[model samples]
Target chain A: MIRAIRSELLKVRTTSLWWLILIGVVAFTAVAIAFNMLATYVTIHPGTVGPQQGGPDSLLTSVTGLYTSGQYAGTLLAMVFGILIFTNEFFHQTATATFLATPKRTLVIGAKLIVAVIVGVVIALITTVLAVGSGLIFLSTQHADLYLGNAEVLKSIGLNWLAFAIWAVFGLGIGALLRSQILSVILGLVAMLIGQTVVQVVLALLSSYFHVKWLMKIAYYLPSSASSIMTSPHGADGFEWWAGALILLAYGAVAAVIGTVITRQRDIS
Target chain B: MADGQIVVTGLTKQFRKVRAVDNLSFTVQPGRVTGFLGPNGAGKTTTLRMLLGLVTATSGTATIGGRRYVDLPDPLRIVGAGLEASSFHKGRTGRDHLRVLCAAAGLPANRADHALEMVGLTPAAKRKVKGYSLGMKQRLGIAAGMLGDPQVLIFDEPANGLDPEGIRWMRTLLSSFADQGRTVLVSSHLLSEVQLFADDVVIIAAGKLIRQGPVEELTNLDGAARQIRVVTPEPDKLFGALELPRTAVAKDENGGFLVTGVTGPQIGKAALAAGVELHELAPQRADLEKVFLELTSGKAGIR
Candidate 1:
């Protein structure tokens, strides 16, 4: 097991894919920071825009929302990292050599899962720190409260990191299930970005017209909805923090099992 | 490292509708190079993959030191395999690529450099695999196979992209590896090259073992079928006069009589008895290439 982990880390360290990891860190954090700065500026200079939209309290939520919201951006990047960790082996035909070196296929999968979790947490932390730090700076410039020691704010940030970490594991499962790197990455991005949007849009239309209050109850268990509630607990009809975490955990667990079983049973040829 | 023999018994692999390997069995002993010879799509790669535990065999077993590859504790320290020259990430340097395997095999970090040096790839060790030429990639594959200095080694078409010099270098390397009492099984579709270095040959055709034995023994079996080519001024007279039992005389392309089922000296003695002048008498030796073609073309059955 130790040898497999060492080998997995070595493979990642030596590849040029590290550039992508760096790009993920900078891109996600920069985008979140820019949005927070723009929002904070608009809140301070209300007359500069057409009209003042929300009150200062709502503005404060949006300001800190950057820190928690950046989790999805980091999750996208971490998921890609996780997918590449396994897909690269298949793409390059290194799986043959890997299995030859360590014939226990499950051990290889396990070690890769460990690497994914580690990378996920690291990327999550880096993006979270940058987003929150930049958010604090922008809000302070407008003399708004930093909320540095607020338990709710701190918990949100911590859960945001945890969300990204779990998403990385989910990415590993997806990569294993779909061995094609391009196909898996595209499907992952679509499911994370467009798939969730489509679901939310359909659910809203259904509830608004049909007045099916019970249908919205099931949305809390969806992975994206669960993750959203985990990072921000103030949403309507959202599951509790523990329930949301369990929902995401369930997704990761199911994906990991399916991925591992398929990988083990399929011939490497 | 003590027991390095490889035994493959009734190994078979079927891919959905097609059978890639069909009850193929062979043994490779230590201290000698065995050439796994077959035409393209003849199941050589599939068999090697099963032996290395890359692909699961549908039936039978392949073992080294009386243990399956996966069953062996620390397989790389016992059996090293290069199933394909292209089995590597294109974005990593050769040295780093080897380091990954070394780390998996629990070998020292310096072994990567040593392996690179062994294959004469030290100069390009730091270059990414993408920029490597086909020959360089082949060399790198060999280096990776030898990384652990294992007792048993397997290579599939190791000489596929090598130049004449590179081929010679590989021949020497494989010979030396065998000389150290380590089992080596190198597969190739080229018969001439394998004949140059291999002590034993295992020939397969259409996913079935056709023939296997020492190189000399296989050639000697064909030696008895050797044809004698005789050049003479009078073709008609020589053809009728040299009447041999079960011997057929056919007109050659250049107007020489190709006498089969007879030796050179018998032809000479018969010529003297017939009082025919002989300009030239030469024995046509049967090489592995000819026998390989005959075997694969279904002209020769398994022996």
Candidate 2:
């Protein structure tokens, strides 16, 4: 297992995509920080008026929304990483060499999962730190209460990081199930964007017409619907943070199980 | 298993309605290069893949070292195989690719360098595989196979894209591998190439093993009854002088005597004794190509 992990790490390290992901995450975080700082400056010293009605907290709310977008961007990148991890074998005909080397196919899959999780967690933590640090620095110029020590600010950063990790796992699941970069990316985009919107709209229409409030609750638990639980200022649908985490975990678990089953039984060629 | 022999029994594979390999049974012994000779689409690649456990067999078994390839602990250390058209990750350096496999197989990292040097790819070690020519890619594949110094090595048309010098290099490499008492099974469509490298030849056509035996046994037509052709002034006298049973003397295109059931040397001795000036005396042995064509043509219909 240790050897397998080492091999997996070597694969990840040698690819140019890994460096690209890291650069993208850091660059997006910096852009998010700059945008927030510019907003704070514009609101603090208006050209015509002395000050704005709402302070940097409104800016914080918008920036926090941007953080979710950034998290999704990171997740998209992870999806690409995960797909390449497996599908590259097929493309390069390395599956034969890999299976011949280890012979135990499941161990190879397990090693890849472990590597993906470790990378996902580390990248998420780093992105969170940079995002929060930059946001706080920008907000400090406007004399806003956006200090890192602030309870709300700390909670937001923590939840954002947690959400980022979960999103990464979610990407892994999608990548594994689809097993092709273009297909996985399309499925991921649909699930993250159109799927959630469609589900929410249908559930809203159903609840309003038939008084089926339970349907709305069910929709909230769906993979995309569950995002609100992490990104919402207050937890969505009165569900605790742990409940949302569990829902995401369930989604990832199901995806992984399906992926592993297909991969193990299918012929490598 | 103890001798590093590969035994395959009742091995079968079907791709949809097409039987790519059917009831293929053959044993490749150690200390000999077994040439897997077949025409194009003769299921050579599929059989090799099944032996390495790259493709699952629909029925029967293939074993190396007395265990299924997947069941073997440290398979790469036990068996090394190179498939044609195998592509390494284009983005990675050749050395890195071998290093990753070495790590997986629990072989020392230095084995990567050794394998590169062995295949004469040491100079191109740092280059990405994308830049490699077809012949260079083949060398890299062979390097990967030799990384673990395994007991059993399989190469599928290893000399496909090589030049004359490269082909000679490959022949030397395979001969050395077999000389080390390792089981070497190499597949090729060219009979002349295998004729030089292989000690034993296994011929297949339409997914069935037509013949497998020592190269000498497959090529020698001694069992077909010796035949001799002679050109002498006295054809009847030459035929009568060679008083062998079941001897047939027939007219030749050049007005020489065509003789059978008598060795060429015996005919020459008979001519010397009979005072018949011989114009032609030659031994006829069936070539490997003729034997291969006859066997595969016969098997093609039954399959």
- Model 2: how many Å of interface RMSD? 1.2
Tens digits of per-residue lDDT, candidate 1, A45-128, equal: 777776876685666566667666467677888888989898998999999889888898999999999999988888877877
TM-score of each: 0.94, 0.86
Q: What is the TM-score of chain A alone in each candidate?
A: 0.90, 0.83
Cα misplacement distance, residue A141 of candidate 1 (Å): 2.6
Q: Write the per-residue lDDT of candidate 2 for residues B63-105, one digit (tens) a residue.
A: 9977888888888888888886456888888999899999888
> Model 1: clashing residue pairs?
none
Task: Report iRMS values in order.
Answer: 0.9, 1.2
The alpha-carbon lDDT assigned to residue B195 of candidate 2 equals: 89
For model 2, how does the per-residue alpha-carbon lDDT over A1-269 read when each residue is reduced to its tens digit?
99998988888887676888899888876676666556555555555345554566665565564333356566556555666676677667787778888878889888877777777777777677776666656556657555445555556666766666666666666766777767876777787779888988889899999987888888878876575576555776688766787888788778877887777766766
Alpha-carbon error at B16 in model 2, in Å? 2.6
